[model samples]
Target chain A: MIKKLRIMIGTNKKNILALTFIFSSLLVLASTQFPPWDVPVEANDLENPITVDKKNLDAGKAFFDLSCKACHGATGLGDGAVPSGDFTTKAFTGQTDGAIFWKIQQGRGLMPSFKAVQETSLWQAITYIRTLAAPQEIVAMKNATIVIEFDESNSKKLITAKVYETLENGEQAPAKEVKVNFFIKRYFADMLIGGSNNYTDDNGSVSISFPEGVPGKEGKLQVMAKLDDSGFNPAGLTEEVAWGVEKAAYWNDDRQLWKNNDFVPLWLLISFFGVIGGILIAILYVLLQVVKIRKLGVGR
Target chain B: MSAETTDIQKTGRSLKEITSDLLNPIRSKKSSVSLWTMLLVFIIIIGVYAYIYQTMTGLGVTAMRDYTSWGMYIGHFVFLVAVSLVGSLVTAILKLLEIKWAAPITRIAEIIAVAAVALAAITIVLDMGRPDRVLNIFLHGRIQSPIVWDVTVVNMYLLISVILLYLPMIPDIAIMRDTLTDRPKWQRKMYKVLALNWRGTDEQWRLLKRSIRIMLIVIMPVAFAIHTVTSWLFAVNSRAGWDSTIFGPYFVAGAFMVGAAAVIAAMYIFWATKPAYKKYITSKHFDMMGRLLVLTGLVYLYFNVNEYLVPGFKMQKLDGQHLMDLFVGHEAPLFWATQIGGLILPVFLLCFKKFRKPLPIFIISIFVIFFAWTKRLLIVIPTLLTPTFPIQNVPESWHHYIPTYYEIAITSMTVALVLLIITWFTKYFPIIPIWEMAKENGHDNPHEKVVLDDIEKD
Candidate 1:
């Protein structure tokens, strides 16, 4: 009977563990679940009026970055702080331009509606989102190179990029009118240095005076020049330069009141312990006197 | 020798008579006292039940939410801490200044101090959502935090107050051990054990006096530190109502005011109820305590003007909002009532010789003590309600705070606990120090000199 009771208790323990596991899993799942959202049928059939071009995509990308990127993520992977629609997914991309537009215009639950946004800007945002669905082919220049140089002849620091393409006869020729973009690499993302008007001249180079007050490690910055036009293979050159403002040392080991117990300010430690210790000794002395009084009573 | 003999004749009662008079309340079993004890016990039981329910459920049982996080419990804590300062004021400060009249009232103040500080410590735990994690405070205490400082000084204050209470009571306890032969065997044993086997030796008296003297001096700063640290718990935060440079002295001043009032209230209750106590706690004591109250109240009034008027003159945006709420807004009634009725009128009325009488001053003290509590709540709640940023996205109930019934019940339990402790101390032992009264009546050694044969006959 005792063995039977032991077996029943063992089974009960297992049952309780299993129940706890199931309950915890349900709680986790319930917390992560998003409420369902629906769009009107008429809204789903509307077409996007804006064409997908470099200029329009650029405008849309700027707007998306300012607003939607915090929720929808940089590459639209729905992996932002707030869970949002992944534009790369068929679940999102298969929806008509009108459905996506309607969702953006009329938000649900945690999602905020963009009713105050301009109509043209909304279409431009849609045009840029379509490019996130899949990768596209790029035609490459067989032998091409880009060089970044710091030109200080004009008193101000200028970052100049020269683009070159090798001809059939193996001669390097200036690749004129080739759109180039210059950027300074930062921790999270590259910051554009030269504006969108950057294009190679007949000398195969474009120049932009370096901006001031950009913080860098030890005053050195990583400058990159990339080919921006669509018909070329992905290419860019990165060079470490000394154009950025020097970053001061951010952290120090000085003692502070806010520091942990090990590193409390020296003066505070002394005063705190000194006052408390003095009082404690006084208290101990009084307690000892009481003990003496008790002993004196015993002797008497 | 002539002066001492004349002083003894002034009381017109022998040392033996004084001892028995003081010890009579302990021997008498009054039905009214039993009923009062029962009522306090009933309230304590209900409070304990509510506390258990709160711990079982959570702090959610209280009306406190995210915005008004430190609600009624914290207000009670501040009030208790403030009231506990009475011990140092009556026993240490007055004794050090050689004020002879305050000697009879010291034990009453010490009892209030011990009870208030003990409840103040418990009230902090009651405010915690997780009372079980209270040990984490000592395990990982940061010295720089105002909270750790508060806990340290409060514990120190409690220890010192208890010692002050106990050291003076040893001779009296010895008196009970020897003279109260008809008490229960357990009661006799308790008195004997707690008496430290005193035979009233000169050396024992010497040590007792020395220890009490040391405690009297040490308790003053520890008492000051306790309330000052409690004030820092608010002043360290950059809240509108609490941000002040003079908060330390301001709190100390306010503490003395309320502490004096609390002592006066206790004095009146004892004087009115126990006929034997009237000779010791006389209208003279009431008149003296009333004057002390008025003095503290005026000092507090000075700090009050500095606290409010300077800020009111500037009327900085946040400070203005906070001041406006107190001056002419929703909280104006409580604010004005606490200031005018509690502080101003009590101070104003107590200044007069007629109003300084026992019955009148006691009534005023009741108002003062009650309004002092409301003043603490006003200091805590309104500032919390007026946040630096607008309070948004919470439930409508979060906007205003009215303590739930459970909170009120739990708070009332602390009050009952204080009263119950005082009642037990008075019932089981003499509240007034017999030896001190005899000494005051010019007996150098009251315990040895006074004949106890008649005490047994009585």
Candidate 2:
């Protein structure tokens, strides 16, 4: 009697493998194609960044000083008392004066569309934003000799570069390409030596072989690395950056900065199916219960 | 086999013939320290205790985890319910078709129907995680759930089944009241109350017949609903083996199949006990039951193929592990055993004339019932073991569930409790419907009346 169920229940190994492949592919597709956490970022202002009126420029400058100046600085070199890095994005640099004026007239993304700000004020901010760049005299480092080494037995790639500085304390670090910005709180205020620039090698690793820049004597130098986002000062670092050629300083590979969320992607699909399952069980249970209770009450 | 010829042959064979001449029943209840009945009863008591413990502790006592929320209780409930459907085959199907061979066993079949359905109800309640919150169901009833459908149909089936068993017993109750001289006065009163002043009038008989007919017709759909809803509980879920479109019919066929097998097992037990019962039941009864088993098996087999083949062809990702688990993975042994031992072999064995004979048919029915039940267990447990995640977290014990000692005790208790109900009912009431039998045999046999009266007398 029991043997009746034993027949032909297994699929061939190859079939199982094929099933596994198909299932995995579907899992990948489901996770990637319909990601749940891609939060929307607005960037509409750049499409039309120009504003024409002189009155609008003044108004734009007022609005800019209220919001943008703290980040881009009074001179837009990002060197205010609290100074920040420049936010002269590609749209700002590439735009015509008219476009820049319009951008000040209307902000985009994190920049609230200040279309409400006077059109003149919007144009003024745009004109200022168009002039975004790093200040000139980078800091020179304290006079010091440094050693460096390259080890390739384990790793196959490395980046090599050097930097020098020309200024101290109030001089500030000159910004490089200004591609990215990171903000730091004011806890480490006593550590500033001040400005310089460093460069990057083709291999993505940075090694300062003859690294020299900033505070060039026995004092301090502020050197900038090619890894800088753009030429903006006051890039919101709390601690004063040390000026020295530390031996063989390099960055490990930046494998990836983001991870694809697994559970959330599958959540919607699972929930959809789960609800369906719940509905089915619910129906069966309710239908039966209603009849049972009714029968029990009615006694017929 | 024309009914005319069958009736003539039946007439030639005296209705008063004693079948107990060659065999005797192993007394169901032991007189001493432990009876076979008590063992089943003890297990049942422990099981009941376990149930009480569960009700207090909540469904946490069972090995059910998040993945396999519905566990052995529901499986047990489903098996018992399937067994309950056997009554329809005996009382409704065979009776309506005028299969005179069913005479001796109809009463027994009815008892099985009542007992199994009753137990099924208890077990389903046990299956609920929040039995306390069960009232919330009525308070907040939803038509969408399969559980509600099941509760509805099962209640209807139970009501109709109990009434079916009772209505046919009126004339016999009267016989117990007045004609049984050896019976004490109190017993007579009890019988009189049950008889409800029945005088065997033509109107009463007509009403009885009409009601039985109505019940039989009504019961068919209700029976389908109980099992079909059970299937939907699985099928509508987007789980692997459960998501099949064919589950409704599959479950129904399986229910009737297992049900027929249960009837066969009960028939054998009745025959073995030989409890002054053979005069009422004949060898032809066994043959008819065997035939019924075969028919159900074939229908179940058809559904099984539809269930397996469609999923196998599609090979969807959701169904992958579920199919593998049943067919080739961990559940394989039980799966195959249920198919072959529970369903196929009994069907094949009972297919033959000799195997369909009383004793062999009866023996095979037990195997079929055991296998059928295990099949239900496999259906539920394996799906849970393979829930989408690589099952992790919590105690490692959460990953697996072999029912605890107390769990088995409670399960056995349910089975024994059901058996006890059937036993008491049969011991007090003559299992053969006297009024129906007398009517069928034309009530003119002085000798047949004498022999039947001898048993009815006490």
Candidate 3:
């Protein structure tokens, strides 16, 4: 039997094994990232003024009682159980009634639509937003520091922060110093200033400030925090916060979260085809060798 | 080709005298066109002109659409690639094993491989959306795409096939250059270019053998890549039926099956035309090719079982409908016919000793090649038509891709073009490698006596 055996092979078992290993590794690498099911968030300026109808206002109150009040608190102050945004802050005034109206209609990040909240109730909710205090009036006399905060509504890490002088053109140039406070459901750590720590007001309020000589100081300043799409528009959603620096500007380094938008969802299709194409070629090469061996036969 | 040599020997007049007498007739153009030859050539020309019209209008003239970007053209290319796979069996496979019977059929198989692969590459280009930017495939190629891999592998296969064809032709070309003292001056010049300064020295002979051995070694992998890449072009896509793990082997087996069929078909054409080749090609050659076909068919059948039956076993929501479309559904007629007529029937027919006869094998091969081409079309188009997205479109035809007249014409052109290339080469060079043939016959010709005596010892 040994004397009669004839072998004419293109690839040995080892070579085929090596090729298979390589393709397997490529498949793993190609499919490492799972396709995203996350929604997207975009800049929306949808504003529509409303008539001062008491019925709509009452409906808005009912709607607000159902959704917004739990976080905003009954007084529209940052006194909710979670110490959510103080609707009655200096930040509140800069946003026009239209902006507020838009916010109520579209619902900001972490918030669901009021579209089903009743057509009249949506306008009513805007009427209530008007009563909230502007950030300028949100001064805490005890610590005498204006506070600005931005973070994820439903579990997201803080991103980046910067303070800047407010300009007439709405550009906020970076300031000399910047700081932010922390409050996780009343577990307040008074304040975390620029590389330092200080306590907030007795009622638990931390203050933020922009140093003097910051370029655009005159008109208005802002502190903004970028929020990723979380707990809301699962498909297309993001959260942002902006406040005047003279009044304590802050920004969340949430660039990563908003950038979640940049990741395309259609990439899964590409990888699926990629793996298929790879295996076919690998097997073809292997089988061709087999065919060669088979054709040559055992006995010449 | 030995039968022609015997015709003169019955009289024992002298082959040398006959050769001298035939020389004038060969050079002079006596205009011998049989009716059948005329008809075949006429059809070939029609296919050529139709293809020309398609090339001018661009792939848009085809029935393909954005969703079904690969329709009949890919279908044809896949079939061609499959058909080319038979070359490995006759050439690399047989030569490696030192099989004596591999000699007569090897050149025929190799020619088919070269022609089919050459045409396959052209068909793929014709299917491209931007054929002019084909260079972009190299410049900005993402190895991620199967298309890029295909471009690399097919080009490599093309190179290997040419080398395989050329190496065996060196001595033959030398003979064409030096032998037959009364041959035309232009014929001698053609032989000189083909010979490339072959003085047939020991060193030259060693170099030729070494190069051929290297190519034979290299060609198996290249051949595999050509068809696998062709299969991957579909396997990689996320379509219903096309998304299969077994597709690579499935395609390889299919390629071998069809390629063997192509070889059989070509053998018959030679049998009917040359009479000389029929003597050497022999019924035994057909029997062997048929056995090889049976093997390929069985392997393809096994793959089909895995490709279809295993998926059917799962009956996953998607796989169920996809298989049904071919099994007992809308494409039932075409799908089953292609699978049965193209694959299963050929396997069954090739199993018997009687059915493996040259004429029967030839008939089976024709059926196999034609059905295999349609099978590829069935594999690609149906899966594409039913994408993940609901089918809503600008035109009804877009929803149901049907190749236009131009597509069919262009496709036919590629076929005709392949034949045209083969015809041109055969008009000059021997279709059966003369040197290899002469060696098998012990170089009885007086001109080769010294060369054969020197080389035959090895």
Of the true interface contacts, each candidate retains a share of 0.53, 0.00, 0.00
Which lDDT value does model 1 have at B252? 96
TM-score top scorer? 1
Give the alpha carbon lDDT tens digit for every residue of B1-458 in model 1.
Answer: 23444456676666667777898888775536578888998777767766765776577667787689999999999999999999999999998898999888999999999999999999999998789999988889988888998888898899889999999999889888888888889999999899887877778878888888999999998999999989999999999999989999999999999999999999999999888888888889999999999999999999999999999999999999999999999999999999999999999999899999999999999999999999999989999998999985444677788897678878999999999999998988788888778777766534443423333444
Best-to-worst order by DockQ is 1, 3, 2
Which tens-of-lDDT digit does each residue in A1-300 have in candidate 2?
A: 123212211311222233333432343233224222221234333333454343343344446656776546666665553223345555346545555454444443223344555554555555545434322322111221111223333333222322222244544333222221111122343222212233323322334322233222333333332223222232221222333333223523333222112223344446434644553454444335333322332321
TM-score of chain A of each: 0.60, 0.23, 0.27
Q: Give lDDT: candidate 2, residue B355.
A: 95
Error of 3 at B263 (Å): 0.7
Docking class of 2: incorrect
Q: Of the candidates numbered 1 and 3, which has the greater lDDT value? A: 1
lDDT of 3 by residue, B1-458 (tens): 24434453454423333222222223335446646446556555555544443444455456676678778888888888887777776799889899887786787788878888888888877777567888878786654566776877776677678768877776766655565335667777877666666665444555566667766777887788778878888887766788888888889888888888887888888777665566567899889889988898899899988888887999877767777877887788988888889888888988899998878889999999899888888888888877777764233456667676556656766776666666656655666665555555544343443442333322
Residues B143-174, model 2: lDDT tens digits? 44557657767776787788778767765665
DockQ of 1: 0.21
lDDT by residue (tens digit), candidate 3, A1-300? 222111112221223243333432333233232343222233234444566543444445556666777667866785553334567666665555555555555543223345445545666676655544531232211111222445444444232333343444766443322223222111232222233332333333334343332222342323322111111111111222322232224433333322222332345335545544564554455435433433332332
Residue A150 alpha-carbon offset, candidate 3, angstroms: 27
Q: Where does model 2 exceed 4 Å of error?
A: A1-300, B1-34, B181-186, B444-458
